[model samples]
Target: MGKVWCVGISPTDPRLVGIEGVTFHSTVNGCDTLLVATNKNGLGGISALEDNVLIMHESLATATAKGLHRMVVLGDTSSLEGRRWKVHAESWDSTMGVSVNSIHGMGQLIVEVLARSAALKGMQVILIRVGLATERNINRHLARAFTHSSVRLESFKDSKIPDLDAWTAMCLDESGEFNSEISSEQWAPSRED
Candidate 1:
């Protein structure tokens, strides 16, 4: 409901351009919520550690400094491995297809770190994974990493996806809630079997 901004990417289309007074910025300055998109430099193996870490680190720090608590990240939050797509909820089910190459994006790390920071700051974050069979390993890691109450994960099922208008509308909707098939505490490592 407050001033929502899109970070990392800009809104060129009219639909995503005008949503509840949403604005675009390179930083998370003066915003109540942020919609962050992944950057190109973050798509790599361990060799791209610096790029992956720095982007998320800078974004989180800026958001914290700006008093921003909520964020919706659109990226490759899942580790597709060989699978085409996946849905994270009470459990990791509803998966199909296979990928040509692996897609382990930096989004998982970004979201995980942000979620932890949010947990500490009493904030909330949602990760909306885009694309199919993009990155399965990271997806698996993310499903298990979202143990904190401050974090939630979801994904788009179709190929030509990310209905920006719908997503932004939901992001701005006060009562809007994202679906996490599995509960965060369900897979907590600390939980005794």
Candidate 2:
């Protein structure tokens, strides 16, 4: 099958590794994100995506609010490799503390995990942060993807968390040839203390 890919840039960790085909370029996003491929064609017409590509999940970029939202799915780059997106939601617990909701919120911690996934498990984790015109636009799409049934909530240790405040919101990370999917479901807030 043909391969579709994300064509963007990142100063923190820029470089599409492992993927069989990919042409590079630059962008202005300062944060890590898990971008749902609404359209590989929308990927800005890179040479790699000019051929056979598999359509995974909804694209947060191209998909219309009425369109992609209907599907209620953001992205699903899952593949044979262990690279996968364990979708989860955000929640707070008395004993465990605050649980991170999305991988995007994980930031560099997510990057560390993806690197480990590729090296140790031999799989890639798809990452994307919506770099639209404004934060409002980005949050709109995130808000939709966040609540999708696919996403769920889980627990994480404080040691692994780089900065809970860093993720005052949600986002995504990783790219290249790897299996990554969106984590959705409990995108709501908890009144618990």
Candidate lDDT scores, in order, read: 0.43, 0.27
Residue lDDT tens for model 2, 77-186: 21112223223313211222223333322322333333223323322122233222243433344443333222222221123433211121223322322211222222
Predicted structure with the largest lDDT when compared to the true one: 1
Task: List where candidate 2 sits over 4 angstroms from the true fold.
Answer: 1-28, 38-73, 76-141, 144-153, 156-185
Residue 71 deviation, candidate 2, in Å? 19
Name the 10 consecutive residues with the lowest summed lDDT in model 2. 71-80
TM-score of candidate 1 to 2 decimals? 0.49
How many backbone clashes does every candidate have?
Answer: 18, 29
- The candidate scoring highest on TM-score is 1
lDDT tens string, model 1, 23-66? 55554556777656565564466544455455566776777778
TM-score of each: 0.49, 0.21
